[model samples]
Target: MTTNESIGDKFISHRMLSSFDINDELLQKLNTKGFTLKSEIQAVSDDTLRLMCNLSDEQLNTINELIRKSHKTIINHLTVSHIRKLSGNRIHTSLPSLDIALGGGLEVSKVTQICGEGGVGKTQICMQLCITVQIPEQFGGLSSHALYIDTENNLRPERLQSMAAFCLESYPELKQRYCAESMVSNVHLFSCNTNSRDLFELIMSRIEHFLDHHQEVRLVIIDSIANLFRYDYKGNEFQREYEISQMGHKIKSIAHRKRVAFLISNQVTYIPVEGKDTPALGKLWQTYCSTSFLIKRYGEYRKTYTLKSVNIETDRHFFFQITKNGIKEVLPDEVVDAIINNNKL
Candidate 1:
């Protein structure tokens, strides 16, 4: 609902100013001098701010200290205590090898971006998480619901149905605990067009209410966040870039506040000469990504996935494949060929 372009941009605010010991007159004076913008105040020298607003040296020093605290509060409210408490409560993705690689699964209060070209099983992985999150926690689930923003309009219920059927057969007790229909229905899908701004608004508005009222929600999936901005503002590069960064901030804020895991699929970009590839939005988008996983085709039926993150202890790279029952570990050609031959069995 807060549509102003500069709404979340200011790390400094009137609230921060009023919280200080400064009088109303000086605050009014600071306001008159157009010191409302955090960047403007942060850019100008403290001496300059003092000169322009006519402040005492002691008052200026206090204001600067308060400003730093305010920025830290607004930018990152995560305290050491909160991190310690939530450390063990991770969202296990339900894939054994990936669970080991991720040290569990996708983590709450952080963003995990899955990067890969088209048809590389990115969406399949997201859908799997959506379904898996419904299982009870003791059985590797978050026992939660999910919000899926389908940017590409590619979320297929048939695929989900098939996957859910597999889960029901494999873990019939999980099915008994919670009905299959309930799990499928819990994954609320929102179709977002190419307008990143609208998509952002949709997400921000629903994030709090969804998590608060629907206590089952523990995951948020934005399948291909890069596409919305790419299509809408192709010529207006500046606006496009701004929206992307702002969107990232909003998503991170919601994830941390709600303590929900974010699975964002991103389009892959690469350098031909170096044979290096990364997500499309550049480092600006990377600032919020707690973990990044890149997917590349290995041979024919297999795909390679590499995990990278400064926060995590180790990097994991492995081969997997898109199969009838969602993503699974790749098997050797001989093993696969033998399995395919009914006579050999």
Candidate 2:
């Protein structure tokens, strides 16, 4: 009689029209089974069909209100397949050269978690990406704007200027767009203490402000997620875990909602194990990241990092390194590939 009354697997069918064929037989079955339609079906505008199908009225109304209030949060992400399609799209960054290492570019609508020990160029890679995405496509970078939320004091105007100048050496016409001060200006930077509730508030405020003005925001980078948990969380163990898990889901939602590439840098610490080396954040953190990259010191100076897991292969681990300028491709050589492919490493 009511929405919740038909609450078994039959009720689930009302949510998605795509789940049912439009045949007379299926329609007759649906009618006979009392699996008719959700109340919201009548109000389902073309744009909101996916939203309606994927969420209950409660979830849809809550997220719909969020979109109405904020521009970046307004986009919809109902299905895992839809989310993956969004993440697979192109991303323009300030670092054109570095795009080569990212298999085209950093994921546009996915959360890319870059984890590394201290002094391993994680910040630098992020900065380079900021620079690379803003350069024109001709130079191997997508010319687009970026947002950098700095929980750490890693952002420097002078450094961004140098990278922009390097980008201009080849693309002289890019001077107007990549002007050191101007380009840096395009990069919206927000500094907030790690543990403060105001940090999350500040982030939300920026998104709301941008949405208010319908600002075009395509890329978002959070310098370090660990710092946020370390400082802001009261660490009640259970509560902290729940909060972190919720935050991870929210971050992923924002990336999809905004249709913007989200890259978050993470700090790594030694995980004690009796035998082999262990990852810092381990399995829990890995679950939140659509793409997880690990940066390790390979040669004396040739620090290599690799895509440990991506959507394609959640467990595929590859390796590469950093150079004086940016990320370098060090594909597994013949001998090394043989050893690895042969299950040696």
Candidate 3:
């Protein structure tokens, strides 16, 4: 039996790929078709792959399993002490009640998925995080840069400008230290279009450049990870799920291992019944995420509900409203009641 080491998450060495069930003709087809890495084979669509490689159903299933094993089994163990060490570099969302609801803040090396309907302030929270992640550690930040991947073309510069101004005004001592002047520069904002393929290729291909050069970045925010799939991929559930789930897995592998935090916003699909709707990408992604939250709009108030969390209550809810400054705290119902009672008095 031949053995090969995992090279930067590779399934097997390119030369040893033929040691398996792949015939010479099939291997030639794969090489000519430019399928090198196991991840590439996994990421490609089955229909397109069929056209390219003319693979039978059995062969395709085998290849799929190989790819899955490559990524999943390659990293099958993590010690508790290792996880504890990684969890130390937590980044606060800076919304006090929301922070309390989150049991502290977003942990380093974890995925926090925020799901909500359109206009539910998911992007607003992302924008706020891009700023908050840079706050000095004394004030509950990682004191590092942020990487913003705007998949739906929603990285609002005007909003960042206004928010940065507010941040400077709010944290005058930090402003005196000149943190605000270069805040946006530390936060790399990228706007990706509707095509998921473009987004995927961009991340996988260009990751080394940014990830290596920007170790200072502690948070990566994908403003609505489900946006590209929602508009496209109608009637193509398998391909959509495969691509999205694989992308999710890849992002998790990179983010956690690099000790960087990920905040991904997922859109919601309405159910028109009880519970109203659920996260758009379904249960695969719901569980793929370390913690899942949902945002709902009511009149002028928006409530963020935790749908899934390992260490926090799923039933817990936090009230917040987006203001010009950024995602700001809003009075809870009890606080509102107390205010009304005081006014009556």
Candidate 4:
């Protein structure tokens, strides 16, 4: 039997059931019972296996032991050196203060979420990272490609072109190795205008395949994962949370195994109890990300506060602004000077 290996050391499809010592007849029965993925088999109850697949007690125990062993093979056992090597490998946001607040920058092999209300530059930051990730490694970038899954259709190629041009101008040396056209082309965009289930399927089924072909892609941006589920699961909060959890787990797994950074943008919802807005999708959704930031807009400037993080201080914030060039840090001195001048007027 032919087996398909997925990210990490796990078998993805039911074709790998043979690895568990299952005969062809039983494998066919499992497939006919709608257990097509290795995960599905692991999730099934022993009673279900007996009643549905006609597996004896002995067979069940053997399959369970094999599944446990299969799982153990993929469990990462990191050494001090491995941890140290991973610590330094991060994708910079190009804004020094923001990078500092982020403990270097958007961390690779982790899921980082940015939540904000409308016009707070969530998508802008995402677009900026898409370009920044492509910057050459010599310039302190990952020198990698980006995959943008646009849920709100907010990604504008013209804006990316302008940002890429500005990046080239900032690093004139980059002009020799990269052009604005090439930089823009490296950012692959996919529009998912459907509901949350479609988005989930895209991540579960197609994303790995796409990443397999585009090995250079080290960053995946999902601009506004909140939009799709906000209204779709109305009055069905449990289902909404369940779907979000599944997607988050898959994304986190992919990020870890592929050594890619996932920058997810989310919307804010008004919490009447707190008398303020907080990241949408509830507290359950927040646990999935390794780090999360909340961006707030104030006129032309924006402040991003760390809601949850591993390396950075909680509630730590830095100011920034969106210009024709892209995201630029609003230094403390600049903010103070502007306040002083406004007071005098």
Candidate 5:
């Protein structure tokens, strides 16, 4: 006849657990009432079910229902899983919608390369993402910091300042909350003019410091992986093949280990395939990268177009203009259709 509340109160109020001590009688009563011994103390205790104990079948069902309801409430309130070992989950980017395109809105500890030819807004995109990632979750971001490893001539304070100013104009509150105190504080940049061993060592040191200091680093961008490749090897085809592959493997491993998104830019060159010419980043580079994007200037349009060549089921091409702003995704269907219709000549 004991109500759930009454039972909880009885259990909570019972000092018998301490006074009576462990005995056959106590164990019998507990077992009869539905208290079972948990086998693995570490495994089940650490799970989403914060507390689960042996109880009568009815009581167990009630507790399970309560836990389910609690989970539903949390989900309804829009709280989701936090990134593992990440301080927070708001990632800022130059383009807000770009984050949306990336499932979980970026900052989930995966390598996301943004490759393009020279002056195609690769570094700019990375910088913008850094700025956006530092903004709080309430403002629609991962609410995490960024670390930028600039291997080229792309680290410009004034440029970042200008980008921040632009973001401020769009979202005044975000500017007030994050940018007013310089959210860029959360962003650490390594702009060393070194290559290969020196570059790797510098990055390794900085990465350690960032991981130690910041609980979460949403993004790490290595601008132009080509720099290290060109500098390390003397353009010997055989040497280049092995070296680039090794570089890619190491980069991929680093990204996986750190669990931060990596966006590495690469150089492109024209190679003869069969009887025709194709633009690519050599054989090793292509083989090593999980995703490959080909970017080239669209004639004299002063804009660069990007081709997402990896992971396509059909022979469909995607094009996006590279502006002073950043890499924007152009819908494949609309652009391709327009190109075909207009270029009937």
Candidate 6:
């Protein structure tokens, strides 16, 4: 049997399967079943494989061993420092205090969740990041494109245009390399009007192709991932959670493999036990995020607290307001004064 010597750490293709002594008929069957990539095959369960492809026990064992070997070859053993050095770069938020609190800015190759109630500026922050990611590297930016997956029909082009204009105006020198029009254009927006199933399919099937063609896209923003799941899966909690886990796994895989950042916005649900609102989708979904921020509206200013994070201290909070330009950080004194004024009124 020929070995898959040339398939070192890359996606398992039909040609590579030939090296495993998989016959042409079996290869065609796998293709028809959509088990094209190693990740796709690995994601499938043994039961599903048996039902879908009619693979016997021995054949299943062989395929599983082949995948394990391929995965082993893909794993890199490195020191802690080496791994940190290899991590993706950050994308600044354009706010000094917020960036400092984030230990730099939004990190690539990780999922960051922004959770908040309606009109708490979750989309505003996402829109700001879309523009900020386009800023030149000299200005502490990723200098790349951003993919905005709008599921709630909340993305406003006028808002993006205004934010981009202000971002450019803040740094006149950036005009040499960037303009408001170009920055706005770099943000690729997709409206997923269908149900949660459609969203899942979009992420699993279309996203990889989109990213392939737009290699410059370093950030992928799914504004309000909770929206898709809100109306769908009304009572089937188990199925809803299962689909969420699968979608999140695919998202994390793409983020790490492509070296891109993923920012997913989540809705807040009133937790009866806590007697307050919490990020929706339950704990299962929360485990997938590397960092999470909970935003609350207080008078004219909005407060964002670090609900959970791997790199930053929890309970750390900051205040910001939404202006025509975009999200601007509000100082502590300003927050206090605003509260006092609102009390007087």
What TM-score would each prediction reach against the true structure? Answer: 0.71, 0.63, 0.71, 0.75, 0.58, 0.76
- State the lDDT of candidate 3 residue by residue for 165-198, as single tens digits: 7987888888765455478777797778758887
TM-score for candidate 4, residues paired by index: 0.75
Poorest 10 consecutive residues of model 5 by lDDT? 34-43
lDDT by residue for model 4 over 1-345, one digit each (tens)? 111122222212212354565667766776555443454555546896778777778777776776667656533442334333546468889778667755688888777899999778999999999899988777767999999999998999999999999999999988988998888999998899988888879987889899999999999999888898899998998788767766765786677668899999999999889897799988767756767889887667787888876455688888888999999997867766666656421
Model 6's lDDT to the true fold? Answer: 0.77
Ranking by TM-score: 6, 4, 3, 1, 2, 5
Candidate 2 lDDT over residue span 13-82, tens digit each: 1232223334454444333322233322333353444342344565445534533343222122233344
- Scored by lDDT, model 1 comes in at 0.69
Name the candidate that leads on TM-score: 6
Ranking by lDDT: 6, 4, 3, 1, 2, 5
Q: In candidate 2, which residue ranges exceed 4 Å CA deviation?
A: 1-88, 92-103, 194-196, 203-205, 211-214, 231-235, 274-282, 299-308, 311-345
TM-score, candidate number 1: 0.71
lDDT of 6 by residue, 63-146 (tens): 778766655544443234433454469988866766765557888877789999988899999999999888877777788999
Residue-level lDDT for 48 in candidate 2: 49
Go through the candidates in order and give each one's C-alpha lDDT: 0.69, 0.56, 0.70, 0.77, 0.51, 0.77
Model 5 over residues 171-255: C-alpha lDDT tens digits? 8777546563385566787775576666656554556566667667767777876777665767676666645544554554455
Residue 186 local lDDT, model 3: 73
Error of 2 at 54 (Å): 16
Report the C-alpha displacement of residue 184, candidate 1, in angstroms: 1.1
lDDT of 3 at 234: 84
Whole-model alpha-carbon lDDT for candidate 5: 0.51
- Clashes (backbone N, CA, C under 3 Å), per candidate, total 1, 18, 0, 0, 19, 0
Q: What is candidate 2's TM-score against the reference? A: 0.63
Q: Candidate 1 — worst ten consecutive residues by lDDT sum?
A: 3-12
lDDT of candidate model 2 versus the reference? 0.56
